[model samples]
Target: MTGGRGRFITFEGGDGAGKTTQSRLLADHFAAQGRTVVHTREPGGTDFGVEVREIVLHSRSHIDPRAEALLYAADRAHHVATVVRPALERGDVVLQDRYFDSSVAYQGAGRVLDAGQIRDLSIWAVDGLLPDLTILLDLDPSAARARLDVARTRYDRLEAEAAEFHERVRAAFLDLAAAEPERFLVVDAALPVEEIARIVRERVDASA
Candidate 1:
């Protein structure tokens, strides 16, 4: 897929950090510029992935930590193979919501698992396909929660975690961005939506 001259852009952030909104805006911006864009998300990008996503995110019982990690890896493996890679191979800009970084943060930091191992699992699952650019939208967990739709009856498994868990997830995201500064663009998620979109577009234009 890397040989196809296409770009893979991923959004990484804590819950309600506006990844979905920003990813859509970026894809739309590229599309308006006449670029072929494929917008997708982890754990639900393919038919197989959707089933896995439902089990992992909405199951009523407590999932074992390792089992949860493996489930995520399985979804990522299938999603990359069936959706992400093929889209990239076709020379289209692939904008993804929540790639490996989410696993590293949610399962590793939030779930108290080894971060290195979680990263390794994700890398192996995706066959070492890293995003060309990862936009990390940094936000305070409290503020993020406020952005959630309160009218909804239940939160997803990860989103229902305590404030401390979200704090750790946020920290892990920043740590990952720090480790790979060249490949990450850390943005303040509290910015106005249009401003955030403009900054993301500028970065994508400069890099992609």
Candidate 2:
């Protein structure tokens, strides 16, 4: 899909899996190599997406699973069109915090929706734009929750979900990595930050 352009790499996992930190480190690595790096996230990669993110992540009221999925797809559509695609075409390494995988794992598995349908909707939303590599930071639910508790005072909608929901999401992410071994680098998120960063760099270097 990239046609020899800059690579798109996404970080996926359950909440508090250290995706944000890992993505930043990877972005910095690429920048040190004199590469243009576009570090962004799913629901807030653009202005339109930021508004959608506020609604989906911070809304105090209930949102149906289907509606939540659609909102994510809408944000993805706009984010890809406005930010991701342009950066890739400019030969910039795109390091994204989340992507369609999160939608499939969270809304599909966590919410008990249809995973296949969620994937299809996302594919249609972004015109089949898939990342060249996806780094899956796998961590136990309890460990991840503890990390969240230490890191923040307020929790988002997804962060506040019960333990079982997070377990389902983690399983879904592992299943996805298993299904697409070439595209996914599954790492233990409990590892030290530098170790995880080293592992990610090795995989990325091999791919490059």
Best prediction by TM-score: 2
lDDT of 1 by residue, 56-163 (tens): 999999899999999999999999888888888888899999999999999999999999999999999989999999999999999999888663567998888899
lDDT of 1: 0.91
**RMSD of model 2, in Å?**
0.9
- Pairs that collide in candidate 2 are none
Worst lDDT window (10 residues) for model 2? Answer: 1-10
RMSD of each: 1.3, 0.9
Model 2 agreement with the true structure over 1-208: per-residue lDDT tens digits: 5524889999999888899999999988998999999899989988898899999999999999999999999999999988988889988899999999999999999999999999999999999999999999999999999998999899999999988999999999999999999889999999999999999999999899
